[model samples]
Target: MRPIRRLLVANRGEIAIRVFRTARRMGLETVAVFSEADAAAPHVMAADVAVGVGPAPVRESYLRPERILAAAKASGADAIHPGYGFLSENADFAEAVVAAGLIWVGPPPAAIRAMGLKDAAKALMQAAGVPVTPGYLGESQDAADLAREAGRIGFPVLIKAVAGGGGKGMRLVEEAAAFDAALASCRREAASSFGDDRVILETYVARPRHIEVQVFADSHGDAVHLFERDCSLQRRHQKVIEEAPAPGMDPATRAAVTEAAVRAAKAVAYEGAGTIEFIADASEGLRPDRIWFMEMNTRLQVEHPVTEAVTGLDLVEWQLRIAMGEPLPLAQAEIQLSGHAVEARLYAENPAAGFLPSTGPLNHLRLPKGVRVDSGVAEGGDVSPFYDPMIAKLIGHAETREAAIAAMAEACEGVEVWPVRTNAAFLANCLKAPDFIAGDIDTGFIARRLDALAAPRAPSAVALSAAAEAAVALAQDGDGPWGGGLAGFRVNGAADPAVRLFLDGKAMLGSPNGMSERSVLADADGHIVVFEGGEAIAFTQAAPGGLDESSGDGAIRSPMPGKVTAVAVEAGDVVEKGQLLMVLEAMKMEHSLTAPISGVVEAVLVSEGGQTTEGAVLARIVPT
Candidate 1:
């Protein structure tokens, strides 16, 4: 059992920062590896030492096992921590780290390999006496044979890639006629996502709830479960909001699930931090008999913070201790769950724009106080197109579930992100939704209420008034016409002061309040752009006579920098309103650009497989 003297985190962003914080508390120096794009990232600055791994692309940097090992060796780091993404679940990387004579702050490579494939992991779980969902794991790749298996599993079956997670390479077939197309699409996605085109079919549980138990084991074969987290709220198969001590879960159900998690761990001789995911049928309330083992995540989870909050434990610290041959810190019975906690991931995306990933500078970012914020980017930091768009996570905890939910809602509402759109308002609305508040959550909850959740939200009258007042105040005594120094001189006593401001090129007129109502001024902090009521409105002195000129033709432009994956139209093609013109892939998400009006496509400026920057016109349309 060798204690680690220095540790190198083979990851980037918030997860790296998270592990570094714990390593520091353990009196271990930390080294960080960064890509070219992240040279000035917050994680790099937080580390005691940093090494450049490679270029901006993850394939050339974070995913390169050789570069990571070399960085660790050059830094003299005795241990390496693979924080959640890139190489966290790569079994070969884990084995290579151990072979290099460095401690790996993770589970055994054998255990990771056992759980790497969902079908194999399910088979292992069933063999270990754990209840598993009914499925077919046969090796037959014939489409006809797979269809027959799907028929046996029944309609609404889930075709999932064996080596996939994060909702990628998964499809649900609700009817027989659509099975072939879904199968083909799923296979294509699987091949692209996991490099494996093989898939397994499972009976899809309607109205299911995702609950995972956090399990930890030490070198001595001792294992304990750190309660459970409810990750039922999701979009695109990725968790959006997670809570600890799942609401509406009874004592019996909790005990059964947690015990099953430990059993699964013991079967593989698991070590360090792992999560056993279970899908619970919630058509009826949560019942132990209805819950089935789905798969095991052989590494720390993104929602680990929620579990840590309720357990009053640092999971990262536990991982370090267990990796160093230490015994489990506490017995299963000694571990206790304290208060309830909820966490919301703040992403740089536009919920209303079909949740398109956004990339730009975080012009103004102010997280609400009185909550825990795990962030890897600072105000003015660029949300680049090279990595995940998650900016930070906000955690709120309280003695009761209701209070915790309320606190999370307040935190989301108070957050201020700008330039790059975010889902802060959407998250706040979800927390307060009638169904959500009553704990009526399931995997289908987001899809069922997506229209309401992603609806275009406008600023409140009060927010508009505040913005108007702030704009007038800034323009007052300033050089612009809206400023008081030049424009405040009223020609008549009967005329009220009016200031012209431009928001997204649209002119706005506003009036200042009387001195008695000027208290709202205190909330102003000189932000040229302010986020209020779920919308960001930028206030700039309008040009005299609104003298903006536009070209004769309507040019459909790309909203963000990305690659044009598809072009649906050519020159001289007639299009209808909202017709798909092109599709742009950015930040790992696809955004479809549509026609704003009926017109004839005069020219297609962008070719298929071409790249474009924000505001780059892809096509010119002449109104019919």
Candidate 2:
């Protein structure tokens, strides 16, 4: 280990800010590397010094280890912390950092490689006596071979890319017929994301609980576990909610899993922060024998905050200390677990619209006040398509899981983001769900109830009345209630002033009343966006006798900046309503664009392999 005086965080967004917080506290100067798209990001301002790596695209920016190393050299940084996503697990990057004589604030290159690939990691875990999921890790990449293996294992098997993480290169195939297509999509995503299309098959745990134990080791060869986290709440295999001290984990089960996790970590000579992920058969109610190892995350996890909340430990501080050749702060016996904590990932996406990414300027942003918030963007910041759409992480801590859930629910309901959609209401619903409250959950819990959970929320009548009152107060051309501008207005005697307002374009009456807090905001254009129940409902005042209106046109435009992967329809092709026209890959996920109405394709404005910016028309469907 080398002395690290100046640290450069080779990443962006909240993770970079998070690392900078610890580095600053430790009396180390922090440096940040940003892309052109992130030139104005808060993370850059959080650091003592910042450097520009390249343009917006990750290929030219964050993914280029050489550029990061160059930034470190230019900034006189003696250490590099590859914060979670871009190249956190890239063995080559770790090696290069060492070769450049900079301390790598991560695991050793050998450890990263040993657990980077799903197949190889599972093999290594099995060899170390860790229980692994019954599946296939055969070396052959033939489609036929994998399909045969899937049949032998059974239907409803999981197809996972060998190098996949963050649910990018994985698919759940429920039947034999869908296997081929799922395999192809998985492979395409795998190649695009990890540069490796090789996949592995796993027996799908119908009622699965995603359990991972946080492990830390040091240069002195001492290791310990920070208990475990339940990351079972997920959508499309991506974790949405995480909690520490997994619900229903008995004492025996905890001991078994923790010991197994330590064994896995010691096998790789793991140091710093790592997580040993496991999949449990929740159908049997979280028995020790039913749990099996899935894979090991070689670097810090996005859900590390929950672990920190429970154990009162700063994992990043431990990483820095370990990298500085220090011993483990405490042995396993000395480490203690405290209160329960829950974390909900707030994303800039529309849950009702198939969870498509929503990109725009955050005209109004208000995170919950009572909980821990890890945010990278501010009130006027833009949520662009150049990176992950996660806006903030809200964590709630309490003495019990139920209390934590309640706090988390209230926090989620207090979120207020306008112009851009969010899944805040959806998260609140999950927190308050009867099943979730009872601790009866699994990995497929969100997927099974996605439709009902994502049902669009409408402002209540009381909310309308509140908005109307605020709008009237703001309309007086003055501030607050009972201003001199409202001198001519009657307060109580007559029928309350009935003002026509459009709630999301639907004409409604804002029952006039007194003014309230700033919970309801009126934009410069006099359009008021009401924040209630985690929903941001826009209300624009209608003219004396008219109302405002909006509609979707027949043009199919890219939702955000992305690469055109497949063009399903061409010019002159007659397509029906909701026909798939094109597929765009953005932020490591594929989005399918469909025809709005039955029509003939007038022209295809973009072709396969072309990069497009937000709102660029890919095709025009002239309604027939």
Candidate 3:
């Protein structure tokens, strides 16, 4: 066992900061690797030494094993920690780190390789006496072969990429007729995402709950389970919220699943932090017999904080200790789950706008003090297009699940983010929903209520009045009301002065949704973002009379900066309302542009692989 005197973090953002904090607490010097775009990132500033790897694109920087290794060597780092994303689970990168005579703070490369492919992992689990969903894991890629396999598995089967994750390269085929088209799309996405077009078929559970157990192992051949987390709240196969001690999980189910997880880890002689995910049938309420192994993430998870809250253990610290060849910190029988903890991922994306990823400067960011917030971006920082759009993670802990949910809702309502769209309101709504509050959750919960959850809500009277009061305050004094000495000034019997405001360029009459009430104003930045009763209302000062500033006539513009990946319509093509025109890939998610009216495509301004900015016209249509 070699001691790591200096540790280099081979990733960026919150995870980097998280690992660095633990390393510092353990009396180790830290180094950070950053891309050009993240030169001033919080992680870089927090580390003892910072090294620039390459350009902004992940392929040239974070995913490049050589650059990261060289950075470690240059900084004289004795060890390297691959935080959750980028090269964390890349077996080749882990092996390279070991080959460079540096300690790797993760699972063994052999274990990663064993669990990298979904089909092979499932087969391995089955061989280890772990239950798994009925599926086809054959090597045949022939379309006919897959269709036959799907038929035997029955309808509502899932066509998933063999080397896929994060919901990319996955599709649901509900019937035999749609098998071919779905397979082609799935293959294309899989190839684009994982560089592997091979796929496997599985029986889709009508109502599935995503449960995963955190397991830790040491080089001394000891491993222990750290309970379970429910990650069922998701959008587009990406986790939105996670909570520890899964609601509605019985002791029997938990024991059986956690035991299986530890077995899976011991089977591979695993070490460090890893998660073994399973899918539970929630239609009949979390039965041990209905649970099936899903996948094993051979690295720390994004929602590790929730596990820490319940276990009262810092997972990153444990990771550092285990990497130094320490035995398991706590035996499985000794470790006990204390309370309930919930975590919500705050992201720079608009749930109402088809969850399109948003990129811009964070003009205002205010998080309540009560919750545990892990964030890398500060106010005035930019959420760039070069990486994931996660802004922060808010964690709430309480003795009961209900109290934890309530605390999370309060945190969501109290957070103040502006300019860049976020799903904060949607998260609050989820926590407040009757079904969710009752612990009736499944993987499909968000999809079933997306309309209500993502729908734009009318601003409450208090919210509108607050914005107008803010505008009035800003108008009275250029700097602020306090600086101008305009406190407690009210004219007697004067006709209530009207303050006109515009929300996202739409006119608001300064009337509250229910009642009109004058209130003290907070300093505004010519823009006001108010979170009231778990809803976000945003507006900026507009010219008198709400002057129309439409960009153009019949122009279909890109809503966010991205590269065009596909153009389905030509310049002269006639299209119906909602007809596909093009696809824009931004922040690793695809947004489809559709026709706004039945019209002829007058011009296609952007071609496939062309980069375009927000509000840039991608096409022009002539109304027919």
Candidates' lDDT values, in order? Answer: 0.84, 0.88, 0.85
**Clash tally, candidates in order:** 4, 0, 2
Taking the tens digit of each residue's C-alpha lDDT, what string does model 1 give over 1-624?
A: 779899999988899999999999889999999999999999999999999999997889999999999999899999999998789999999999999999999999999999999988988998999999988999897999999999998998999989888777788899989898788767766765567989999999988999999999998978999999999999978899999989899999999999999999999999999999999999999999999999988899988999999888999999998889889888988888899999999999988878888888875677778888999899868898888899999999999989999999988877776667889988988898989989999989989999998775654444445556556545554424321111112222232366565655667765544321211221123434445544555556644454332443588877888888778899989999898898776775556788887899989998977888987888988988
Worst 10 residues of 3 by lDDT: 482-491
Ranking by lDDT: 2, 3, 1
* Model 3 spans with C-alpha error above 4 angstroms: 479-495, 504-507, 511-526, 533-536, 540-552
Residue 605 in model 2: shift from native, Å?
A: 2.0
User: In candidate 2, what are the lDDT values of residues 1-624, reduced to their tens digit?
Assistant: 467899999999999999999999999999999999999899999999999999999999999999999999999999999999889999999999999999999999999999999999999998999999999999999999999999999989999999999988899999999999889889988898899999999999889999999999997888999999999999998999999989999999999999999999999998889999999999979898999999998889999999999999999999999999989988999889899999999999988778888888887888888899999998788998889999999999999999999999999998888788999999999999999989999989998898889998877776677667766667664655422112123234333677778865578886766433336666666566667778777777764333211134577877778889888898999999888898899867988787878989999999899999976878888888
Query: Compared with the true structure, what per-residue lDDT tens digits does model 3 show for residues 14-42?
Result: 99998999899989999999999999999
For candidate 1, which ten residues in a row score worst on lDDT? 483-492
Looking at model 1, residue 306 earns an lDDT score of 93
- Whose TM-score is higher: candidate 1's or candidate 2's? 2
TM-scores of all predicted structures:
0.89, 0.94, 0.93
TM-score of 2: 0.94
